[model samples]
Target: VAQHRANVRLWWTRSSLKEHTAGLSNANIPLFFPKLECIDNANQSHLHRLEAVVAAKCVRPGASLRSIGAADVRGLCGGWLYFRQRGGSPAGATFCKEGTCRMGCTSSAEERAALARSKQIEKNLKEDGIQAAKDIKLLLLGAGESGKSTIVKQMKIIHESGFTPEDHKQYRPVVYSNTIQSLVAILRSMPNLGISYGNNEREIDGKMVFDVIQRMEDTEPFSEELLAAMKRLWTDSGVQECFGRSNEYQLNDSAKYFLDDLDRLGAKDYQPTEQDILRTRVKTTGIVEVHFSFKNLNFKLFDVGGQRSERKKWIHCFEDVTAIIFCVAMSEYDQVLHEDETTNRMQESLKLFDSICNNKWFTDTSIILFLNKKDLFEDKIRKSPLTICFPEYAGAQEYGEAAAYIQAQFEAKNKSTTKEIYCHMTCATDTHNIQFVFDAVTDVIIANNLRNCGLY
Candidate 1:
């Protein structure tokens, strides 16, 4: 009976040992169960229990053998068994392996150090998450020629290092193109307007201007013959009349500005001025991202094409945006869309704004309305009637009432009572105006974001 009892005890010890070491591979035995000359047969049960605790603490789910370190084993084994024997929790307890049972061992320093490191790693992760949440993402959206791209340029000038020499050089061709294209558009519109050229002799000059438009490469500079023709045609009372009635047709806002300065534009060595860069028009085709730091806050402004065909790409940029800057050409109230002359431009802007302001993707996003091109709008309001776009208007044809009515038109598009549209009257070509408006905009953005975070 004594022999059988001894045999049962030995079998029980072997079973516990196998169960504890089951997770350790043959190659990792030395790594975790290093040779402990201090351990003896008397403490073999304690060793098995310590091994179980070490396996439980150090063998993480996805941890490989190489990631398991000796310090980790030491950290786990330091005081685990002493606490287990006393029916106490092993947490923050130290074990002594000096051939006797001792609690609160000195080797627990490693465990405390590992705990400190874990806390620091957790702290760093939290800080990174906070920073990511604070980043401001702005989406620029509106109808084409609404001055969205010009706002992007203003940001570059204000925040980034102003344009380089290469930038001036690049815009030189664009300025020339604007100058030539504006003249050709005027000449083409004359026939439709039933207006004759001021000079019957200058009809040949108009033909020369048309030829330049057909064959001129983007990089090609204006020839003296073409310059002379544009000057003569621009001076023609007939062309001037057509230009005054430009709202009836599609002409760039910069056409009059560039045509008036043909001499400087056609000079032998001309570099684009800051104002020239501001006025130059280039259609935004795809997504454009501009980053800047303002008021200690990082900003990422995204400019997407506002045309119907280009708007399909706007969805890809909808994710993670902080706000939307919806630009509307205030002057376009009297004009028609380039795509469809039958469709009024201001009405198109309203429809587009209504679609996005209440979109599912931007239900919580802030909307900023930019009533842009105030300079043109003010000038045109004095001459062209606002009744062309808003025939229901009975107010005086002055700037204040006209401007307020335009702002209200856009504001009425927001169907969400919970969402407020922050509106600004902006002249995109005026740096001071844009700078002042953006400062106010930054304040609103920061305040809204803080309120959303429950920090207000």
Candidate 2:
């Protein structure tokens, strides 16, 4: 325990948290979390191809220890260390972090990355000195019920450095069902809740809006099928249905013009053509806002939908992603393998993986893969076999066996696959060993920086 405390302390010092947060002012958008999703049955991709694909999208311009938040901590051990992804997207190669930032990390590769990052930081800061900073926007994307909210919460509590327990609770802001259909249903059914031109902000107008919000208060589980149902009513010939065939009481020139583009707003998949990724499966970029900190530097994440259609729209926000977190939902395996459901989450996930490996969008990107929702198997339903072989998991090898078995299904396409891909059976519950996730995340980011600086 003393060693652990000592370790955390060392990391904190290295992060050198801002005596006063530099970028954010009191007036800026005071920590806004996107709307909570309420997915009754979110698509779960059993194959981890999404993991490899997503990691291949990270862009890290600064190659310095001071740039990465990994070098400050101590006593690193266990969990994912670093990831080595290939071919897909624009940006730097190798999304890795290390040093004190790889806190409590026991992985050898991660440790090496940390050391390299530290050396690089020392060199860069000494020669060029610090410069102006900017805020990084990260899109947190995942299917409903995949624990995007929980991961956001854990990130706030552990990775942000100075956030109080109270602040952590407010990270996701509230715990609610995060489903795509439900939110669209609310807005589509209640047109009054529309937003201005190009922002996530929403506005509620007219009487029908109140009634609709009240109805949404029921808090029932909403599914993609439901969203599809609503889409039928809202769209006719690729046009908005809110004005009811344009028979509304009145419409300004701007309102009329707005209607033309409104239907396509935030809807990545307005049309479905062959080779259209998301439309072939899940048809939207289901991303919400995510805010966290490392070394006092804020990382606002926006994880877009893993489906094909959504991938097209990610470019809008991919201008400068410091790190990318690609997640593979464990339930996707069950949904596809069991044959009980028509839409196989595993198949959809695999298709997305194929696109990532083959897509030009990820040609230069680097990122990390997350085998999320390990806690789902904690119950007897998904327990491991009695005999398994894996040293890291040791006693849990029986359980770990399932991970290896599943991993085979979604391996990356790169032959070298040189970018290390570390797999962890994560719960996404954000419980014990949760910080390890952030540690791993930061470690990868740092490693990438060091490599860029030519330190490692």
Q: Evaluate model 1: give its TM-score.
A: 0.73
In angstroms, give how far residue 236 of model 2 lies from its true place: 43
TM-score (all chains, Cα) for each model: 0.73, 0.41
- Across 405-438, the per-residue lDDT of candidate 1 in tens digits comes to 9889889988889999999999999999999999
User: Across residues 1-456, which tens digit of lDDT does each residue of candidate 2 receive?
Assistant: 122222222211122222212352323211210111111122122112111111111122343324333221111111121111123221222223332222222446545664555445445543432221333344444443344555665665465553454543332211112222233333443344342212222232222323434676312322344334433433432224343222122121123222233334225333311111101112234555667667645567664543434557655446445444556666444333222335455455555555553445444344455667665544322433222222233334334666665565556543335444445567664445667766666666655544532334
- In order, candidate lDDTs are 0.74, 0.38
Q: What C-alpha lDDT does candidate 1 achieve relative to the native structure?
A: 0.74
Q: Worst 10-residue stretch by lDDT in candidate 1? A: 8-17
User: Weakest 10 consecutive residues, lDDT, candidate 2?
Assistant: 32-41
What does the lDDT read for residue 430 in candidate 2? Answer: 49
TM-score, candidate number 2: 0.41
Model 1 segments more than 4 A misplaced: 1-126, 217-219, 310-317
